[model samples]
Target: MSDALSEASDLSGDDSQDVMTPTELIAKLEEAWLNEKFSPELLKNKSEIVECVMEQLTHMEENLQRVRKGDVKASIHRMEIDRIRFVLSSYLRSRLQKIEKFFPHVLEKEKSRAEGDPSFLSPEEFAFAKEYMANTETYLKAVALRHMPPNLQTIDMLKAVPEPCLDSFVFLRVKERQENILVEPETDEQREYVVDLEEGSQHLMRYRTIAPLVASGAVQLI
Candidate 1:
């Protein structure tokens, strides 16, 4: 369908030469899900992938509505829908947990971001974060802040929550070959080194070094 093709194109983000097929689209979602799961910090949001997958599921469901209840095709369609639904729900749930864990930091990042920047939080997520922030403030004020000195009454959520550990090491597979990646030493006793990333090679390295590569889709976190 035209609508489905359009949605798929949006996910490509570049290389509009071809719309991503359902299989490739699902692969992209799985990549996002695993990257979010393994990364120490919340990664860039992938709402476009979510939207496109939803489109695929909806189209299939619509087709199934005309099929008989006992039809084998109907059963197959239901299984496919459920499969994609599970992945979509899990990906969203993972992001929400991270938001709750680092809400203050999430809000701070969103607020300080410049105009025209891609938001770290989707609109729905922004609302959730705001509501969570309000509730937290109310509870803290009643439970502890009211009794503290005026200067100490204010809580800095950034300081209250732990930051994502960028220095942590991650296992990644290079999707595209890259040259001259800097690998920082774990201690001062060792010297820093640079290495070329060959396409299809897997590496275990500190995340901070290849965070940009991960974002660019040059590497995938297994």
Candidate 2:
């Protein structure tokens, strides 16, 4: 049950006390997957959950290697491994796409982070973003900027790629009741209002309005 958590200290790079049974670990990965898929911007990195899942996969795979091919138990183990691999690869690919699309913004956010604040990116993601940024700048300068006047040559990537549409509509389910959340108007003619998020209720609303709630685990993006 705790096999997945065996590498917690090694993967997390800290003596983390957090522990989860295999079921809990899988649930966390699924939850994280949903949140990442729905959010316009990259959410906080779920490195802990990812690390544990990876550990589980590795342990299961090693056991499978000891079994003969096509055994019943081996078949089931391989199926589970493939399923986990699918989710893990999808989750990482989604993040990498965002990093490529919004590298400037991602790096800026990491740069401005205060000391002791939890990182929005994992170490690998941060390095990827940095490399992506460098490559982009080089490409731009070589193909376009070199021909432009000096004054016009400088490119601000932050302005070039717009930030994620935080105010975009999103569908979510309330996990815990939240009171008096402000909802901005859809049009100038309409007035802003507030509403309570009843537990277990699902609604379509602006992401910005519930952004904090999503980060706090008060709601689940459908």
Highest lDDT scorer = 2
TM-score of each: 0.89, 0.91
**Model 2, runs deviating above 4 Å:** 1-14
Tally clashes: model 1: 0
Model 1 compared with the native: what TM-score? 0.89
Looking at candidate 1, what is the lDDT of residue 150?
92
lDDT of 2 at 210: 93
- What is candidate 2's lDDT per residue for 12-41, written digit by digit as tens? 324446655677778778888888889999
Worst 10 residues of 2 by lDDT: 7-16
Tens digit of per-residue lDDT, candidate 1, span 69-107: 899878887988898899899999999999898888889
